[model samples]
Target: MFTPVHADFFNAPTLELSRNLLGQILVHELPEGVVAGRIVETEAYMGAEDRAAHSFGNRRTKRTEIMFGKPGLVYTYQMHTHTLVNVVAGPEETPRAILIRAVEPVEGIELMRERRGKHMPMKQWTSGPGKLTKAMAINMDYYGHYFTEKPLYIAQGNPVESVSVGPRIGIGNSLDAVHYPYRFWESENPFVSKFR
Candidate 1:
């Protein structure tokens, strides 16, 4: 019963798209059940010009090629053991992406609780990039998949009343690009990644 956001929605500038992502719903259709969450936080990485971007200076490898693909695709990769999810954004040839940093659980709460932890506090459940992915069952299997469709997709959800902007987190060596306030999150959202 969720309205899927159009691919054109993500074809805009990365920063704007990231800001607009707040309050959208991320849905996952798994065999066990449908899990969904309202996006509360996101970080934008603008193409190769941005030093923190994976495609920084055209560093396109087999892993990053998909980031250059069309918008509205899932660009996922493993960091250590956990899978991190991103929405491929910007124009067709640009390697831009918006990393979904946090979400507020909206569906399949019990499944999320079971995957994250039954005893953990609600904030710790989906409050971080790694934490939310685990809770929502996002994995590498979703890599390069068109997210404007089934399995994984975004839906229009609650409207963001306000947004907070800040520098991207955990990238200290990226030079001056680190100062760009590309991270967007719902103001005072407790579920936002702890770094916020």
Candidate 2:
């Protein structure tokens, strides 16, 4: 049985949580049942220095408020009608996060298939951020919610040792940031984002 870590675990510095979360499991409990998956892909976004980050240049707003909250919380937001999930990182007031881009489904296959609206092969089920959220039943309503407890949480799992680093995906505004290797993933993981 897997259990979630305390919120303080995720409150570490941005770079630390960003790297340590590589192999953790993100569990989503739906009314149908529990669906769990191992996180394989992530991108670190530091507060002021990262141009592609929502908190870039210290631009605070109602939407970015949760980024400043205690870490280990889900900072879900809408992007072109799709809900993208990110884990809040860094100490209080420093607004940093790790975008959960992909995951490999580890439990509740039947529930995931139903939510995806098709019987996708394992690799296709949660290969993208939006797709993973869809499979896990996560949405904007889950924004600002704590991940250590509640409908969504992260659990300790087998750590991924062989990981590859690369640039972030789909950010046209960030000219130089597009080249920064902030994204991390387990090499040979079938569920990694195809965009990279």
Highest lDDT among the candidates is held by which one?
1
Report the Cα lDDT for residue 181, model 1. Answer: 94
Clashing pairs in 2: none
lDDT string, candidate 1, 1-196, tens digits: 8778887787778788898889999999889999999999999999889999999997889889999988888999988898999999988778999999999999999999899878998778999889889999898999988878888899988779999999989889999988999999998989988773
List candidate 1 stretches off by more than 4 Å.
Answer: none
Q: What TM-score does each of the candidates earn?
A: 0.97, 0.95
Best by TM-score: 1
Full-model lDDT for every candidate: 0.90, 0.87
RMSD of candidate 1 to the truth, in angstroms, is 1.1
lDDT of 1 at 105: 93
Task: Write model 2 residue lDDT over 81-101, tens digit each, in one string.
Answer: 789999988877888889999
